[model samples]
Target: MNSSEIIPSLEQSLITTDRDCIQLGSEEVATILVNLKSEEGEIIEEGGADVLIYAEGIEISETEDNKDGSYRAFISGAREINEARVGFRLDGKPSTKLITIRVQERCPEPFIDFERTQLIAEPPEILNDGKDYSTLLLQLYDREGRLLDDKTPVSLMANSGILSSTVFDAEQRLFTAFFRSRRVGEVGVYVSVRNVRYPVTIGEVRVVDPEPPEEEFSIIPYESHTMLQSSSLYLQAAGSPGIDSTKGIHLRWMLRGALGELHLPKGNLAEPNQTFNRSEDYVKIYRAKYSKVSFTLNLNRERPAVIDHANRLWIYRKEETREIYLYFRNAAKYDSLISNMSADINHSNFIALYHPELLEFECKDDLFLKLV
Candidate 1:
C-alpha cells in the first residue's frame, strides 16, 4: 500500500458503467465523478499519485439538469455510491492535488418491502405425498413489491429433514416446511430468511405443535367459569403510513373464543421507538400492542421445555392488521423489547405482542384485562 500526494482537480471525475446502458431494474454498471475546488472557487486540475479512483456497476449519464444547472447524474438508478476522499500530502503545500471519484452501481432499491413481504406456498399446505417432498414456490419484489421474478425457489429442512428445513430463492428468503404430522404429535421447526438486497437475515419463522413443549407448571384462577374451551385471544400490529413512533393506543387484542376473535385495544410501547441521524428525525418501521390471550390443550409430557413462566405465557390467533399498534425498542445489550409479554393458553403455543415503543415495566398505566 503506497501512500502519496493526491492531485486536486475539478470535473476530472470517473463515471463508468459496466453496461453502456442497462435494462430498467437490471443491476449492472456504475458511474463516478470527482471535483476538487480551491478557495479561489476554481476546481483543482493537478492529478497526483496519492489520489486514485475506481468503481463498479455504475454509469455516468449525460442528462443535464436545468434545476441544478449541473449535467444530470444522479446516484443513477438509486444505486448507492460510497463517499470517498482524495488524499493530499498536505505537507504545508499551498494547495492539495486532486484524484478521481468512483460512482458505483450497487443496488440501493430495497428488493423486498418490509411490509409487503409474504411467504407463499405452492399447492397450499405443501402436504407430503408419495416420492414428492413438498417445495414452496416463491417470488421477490422491490419497495412497491411487484414480483421481481415469478419463479423464485424456496426450500425446507429439519434435523435430517425430519423436523424442519431452510428455503432460499435467488433473492434468498427462507420458509420452513411444517410437514403434515404423519400421526399428530409434537413437531419442532425453525426458519431463517435472506436476500441479495439485504445485508443481514430478513426474517425468521418458528413453529410448534398444538401443544407447548411439556414440563412442570402452576395454574391461576379465572372465576365463575363456563365454556372452558370457548375463550381464545390474539395480538396484532399495524404496518402503515403516518403511524407515530410514540403516543396513544397502538395495539388491539382479541378474545378469539370469548367473542369469536374480537379485537380489544391497548396502549403503545415505552419510549425511544427507533434510531435517527443528526440530520433526520425519528422514523418508525414497525410497532404494535397486545392483551392476554388464553386457551387449553391436554398434555402428558410427550415433549420437553418445562414451563418456567406459566403466568407469563399466552396464545393468540396469527394474523396481521393495521387498526392495532406494536412497535419495538432497543436495549444496551442490543436486543429488541417487544410488547408486554406472553402467557400459557393450554397445551399449545405461548404468545407475546411486539409493541416496539413501550416497555410494560416502564409504563404507569396498569396492563390488565379490561373488557373491550
Candidate 2:
C-alpha cells in the first residue's frame, strides 16, 4: 500500500513496437513498453519496474531495463515451435499487460526418423492367394520430432515371396506401400533414405498358406429321390480339405437333370456348421434345404459362356433322371466384408462329359477360380 500510494502504476504494453511473432534461427530483438501513470492521472517521469519473461521451446538470452518503465528481451536459438510471454511490474506493484512472441521454423530439414517410426498393415497378415493383398502405412518425421512437410522418396526392399510398391502423400505426411505375398513364408521389409548406408527393417510379414480344406467326410441326403422331379430336398455332408478358420468356405450344389441342362444355385448351397473330427481337430459340415433346383444350359462356344440365373427355380419334368455335383472352396475376409471368389467352377476332367462329377476338387495353387 505504501509503494502503491507513492509510485505510479504501469499500464499499456507493446512488443517490438508492433511485431509479436518471430521466426526460428533468427537473432531478433524484442522490446516491451509500458506507460507509468500516477494516482492523480498524470504520466510519471521517474518510473521503476522489474521485468520477467516466460517462454517455451526457445531461450531468452538477455533482458534489460529501459530506465523509463520499459524493458527489452533478446530472443535467440528457437529449439521448437512455440510461444513466449513478456511482462513487467512497476515499483513492485502488479504486473503490467503481457506481450506474446511466437517462434516458428524458418527452414525445414526433412528426413526419416527410424527410431520413432510407425508402421501398420491393414489386414495385419498376408495369405497365399496371389490376389489377396495388404496395405502398409508409414509415418515419417525429422530429427527434432517434427513432421516433415516436404515429400521424400523412400526405397523399399523385401525378403523372398513378397511384392511391394511405395507411394507418398505429401499433404498428409503419410506413406503407403502395397504388398502382395507370392508364397507362404516369413518375409522381411526394409526402408532407407537415398544414399544412406544402412536400411532399417520396417516390419516382418508372416505369409501363411491359405487354410486347407478339411478331410473328405460324408454327404448325407436327408430326402430320398429315385426319379428326379420338382420337389423340396434336404441334404447335409461332412468332410475335409476343410474350410479356412478365418475365411469360411464357398459351397455350391450343381444338379443336371435328364430334361433340364446343368443347374447352379444363385448363392452358397450349404451353411457351414462347426464340428470336431475323429482326430479332435475342428472341422465344418455343410447343410442346405433346396426348395427347387435352378439349371442353365451350357452353350457350345469358343469363349467361356456366362449364365444369368434370374432368381427362379429351374424345375425338371417328373420321372427325369439327374446327377448332382458338390463344390467347396475358400474365401477371404477383412476389416469391412468378405470378398468371395468367382462363382465359375472349373473341372479338371474337361473332356469327360458323362463321368461322375468330381465332388471335392483341389488346385495345386492358392488361386482356385476367379469370380466374375
Candidate 3:
C-alpha cells in the first residue's frame, strides 16, 4: 500500500454515489476528491476562523438534474481558465474537479500535505492599443520555500459567472475589481492558499465580451523573456544598427500627460541615440525623443522607484529640492535595469511579469500560473 498509503486510503474512501452521477459521455470527466472534514472525518480544528475549504462547483439546480447525470462543460475563450487535475479537460485536457479541500481549524499535524492544484486563466487586463502595450505582469514565489516568516494571503476568484471577490494588493501582487467592470458572460478565476498550513488551489477563466478591436498590425509577447514587471510602460522602438548582446533596444517611453498606455516595463529596448546613464541616489539620463522614436526619461536619477529594492533603500532624487531620498538596496544594485543614452547603476530587474498561463486543461504548456 505505497503511493502514500494509497492516497490517504483512497482519499478516505470516497462515497456519494449513484455512481456519483454516472452516465457521463459526450466527453465525460469525473474526478472525486472530497475531504473537508467535520461531518465526522477529521483533518484538524481547535477554534476561531476555520471553514478552510468547502469548494462546490458543478451544481446544476433543477433542470430535471439532467436526467440524473449531473454534469458541466462549456468554454470558448474571449477568456477561459479551468483546472481539476487527475483526468481533467474541457479541451486542453487532464481532468479532475469534484474539487473539495476543506480544513476546519485544527490539524496541527497528521495528514495535510497534498499540493499540486493548478488552473490559471487570465486576460483581465493587459491591452494598450496605443502603439503597443499589453504585457506588464507580476508574481514571484517562495510562498513556503521554508517559512519561519511569511504572512501568507493568495486568494483569487473569478470563476466567471457573477460570484466575485478579488482585490489583493499586498504591496502590488495586484488583483483589482472596482466591481470588475460589471461583467456578464465567460468568467472563472480562482487561486488559493487561504487558511494556511499549506493549502493551495488554482483555477481560472475570465473571457467576457467587450475588448475586441485590435487590428493595425498586431503581435506582442514577453510571455517569457521570463518574469518581471514591478512597474513600467515605456516603449520607443526602432533603432538597431549594433549592440544587442541578446535583446535590448526596442524602447518607447510615454508619460507627458499620458492617458492610454502603461504596462511596458523594461523588457528589451534601448539603443539608438545611445548615451544612456544610471546612478542610484542621483544621475539618470535617457534623452532621445526623436519624433516618437522614444526615450525621454531623464529624471537624472534621484530615487523614486517606490523606494528601490535589491534588498531595499535607494531613493534620492533631488531636482534641487524637489527632494526624494533613501539609499542602499545596494545603492542601485550595480545599475542597468535597462539603459540607453549613457549612465549606469546595475541593470537586472529583468522584467517579464507573471509568466505561465495555460489552462483549458493542458496538453502542452505544462501549466505554470503566477500572474499576481
Best TM-score goes to which candidate?
2
From the highest lDDT down, the ranking of the candidates is 2, 1, 3
lDDT of 1 by residue, 1-372 (tens): 011122322322222212222334444433322223222222233333232233223433543322211121333352355433222222233223222334344424433564655544433322222122334433444577565442432232221112222334445543434333222222222222221112232332222223322221112235323223222445554434426534544455454542332222222332232211123333334554545663232222222133333133222222321111111223321132112333233222221233232322111122224422
lDDT of each: 0.30, 0.45, 0.28
User: Model 3 lDDT vs. the true structure?
Assistant: 0.28
Pick by TM-score: 1 or 3, better one: 1
Q: TM-score of every model?
A: 0.18, 0.29, 0.16
Count clashing pairs, candidate 1. 57
Badly placed stretches (over 4 Å) of model 2 are: 1-111, 214-372
**Sorted on TM-score, highest at the top, how do the candidates line up?**
2, 1, 3
Candidate 3 Cα deviation (angstroms), residue 341: 51
lDDT of 3 by residue, 76-99 (tens): 111112321111222132223333
- For lDDT, candidate 1 versus 2, the one ahead is 2
